[model samples]
Target: MDAVARVRWAQVGAGGHVARRTSAWWERLVAAREGRAPQRLVHAVLEVVVDGSVRSVDMAPTWGRSAGARRVVVTGPVGSRLLGWWPLFRYELRVVDAPAPPDHVLHVSDDLPLPADVLDDLALVPALTWGRDEAGAGDMWTSNSVVSWLLERHGVTSVGPPAGHRAPGWDAGRCVARR
Candidate 1:
């Protein structure tokens, strides 16, 4: 609205962009634990496919820079946090194929309806959900409440309950289909 306010706003915007581009949690955690710093995060486009048709594209997290992470935590609300709910979905990532995701994600699977925590701990690399919400790309997500915030592109979302919920564990594998 004012000159000073505009300058402050621009500064804040630039800082936010810098933070997002920094190494993802997994990269920092693994590199620190191993007594080294990761050179970069591997960015990959998750292509959910079935019947040879591209179904969806989940931009996933900034941590996408790393390959071979078998486990990743999808965050959600944990009851009330005095102010209604937690501020930001604290997404914790564990590459069991790296180690330790629970300590960061906070909530555990024992409390939720699904074994989401464990599934994330033992998930296969490049996993996915069943498929399209069918309401068209715009409204297909069951509950994009959080993902709408994390996705770096166009504020994305997908089927609710995270991919691990419908995964049926690492053995059954994941799926991808378009409407």
Candidate 2:
């Protein structure tokens, strides 16, 4: 493979239970050279902490640190994240540890509302998840692509593939389905 191709592949990443780094020098160096801020969604970003019987859910800062969260669960293979933190990225679900209290956690999944509490406590949060085609190169994509893809099962056409730099934003006037 060519040098440029290899570098792009590094950015797309492989997905199979990869853990996150406190720091990634290569990603940082590239960001510096590009002179661009990390890609992040300006939409729903919430924090949820599940303790014994009760779940505390709230809106989190746009670039909140999930490191402070206590426990995390994920549905699919995870990988290192280049942009800011979000529940959809699986960065929040990198481990399976017991929670102490006042914890933040995420469960990345193809399914939603996967039994967090005896009752429902699902709320919309600003988040993003990026993925690449199985080949992991120019086919890199992001955001609610899975949802868009799944729509096809229900007879909804996927208008187009997700944009490579997507971190879907929300507004009162705009609907996610239309994206």
Candidate 3:
């Protein structure tokens, strides 16, 4: 990574649980730099729109700091809420089409309500679970189910600790390449 290249991460759902994890990592990244190393910042670039206007921008707090970002990690829904935060992050979102070093990681649950066409448009694949166990249905992905499906299909690696792990400030785990 370039010294000046800011680690860019984007969260689609800022209000969700996964968004909190992403934000925690961003905050930690910023602290690690301490004005010396390159900055690692997340953004709420995409918006989730249902009717017509904006709905939510899950990763808005990330845009307040660090300016250089190269990748987007979507976790929640993208609708009208997210549209409002687009100006903060001017970088275009790149959807990973295959197994690769994911710029971001998303949550994949079974309960979220997303249109079939939208899911098809993104070409998402189920993270694949052996049915709910002790963790119950919620034990699945930590972020939005829609984002999780897209990530699993494209083979993008997730950063930071798993949904519930160590302190909020830290990468879940090194980028995991599927194939």
Instruction: List per-prediction Cα lDDT, in the order shown.
Output: 0.25, 0.28, 0.30
Q: Give the backbone clash total of model 1.
A: 5
Candidate 3, residue 128: CA error in Å? 12
lDDT of 2 at 39: 39
TM-score-best of 1 and 2: 1
lDDT of 3 by residue, 26-109 (tens): 556655766544233323122233443222212222344444432243322222334535644222222322222223533212
Q: Rank the candidates by lDDT, best first.
A: 3, 2, 1
Candidate 2 vs 3: which has more TM-score: 2
* TM-score of every candidate relative to the true structure: 0.24, 0.23, 0.21
In the range 1-179, model 2's lDDT, one tens digit per residue, is 10000000011222222312322443455457779654312111122234433232222223355566433332232233453344444433222233223212122212122233311212121233334333222222232333332233333342322233222222111233333
Clashing pairs in 2: 44-125, 44-126, 45-126, 69-104, 70-104
RMSD, every candidate, angstroms: 20.4, 15.8, 15.6
Clashing pairs in 1: 41-65, 42-64, 42-65, 42-66, 95-98
Better of 1 and 2 by lDDT: 2
Tell me how many clashing residue pairs each candidate has. Answer: 5, 5, 23
lDDT (tens digit, per residue) of candidate 1 on 65-170: 4555443444222222232233342222233232222112211222111121222222222222212222233322211211222221221222222322211111
* lDDT at 143, model 3: 27
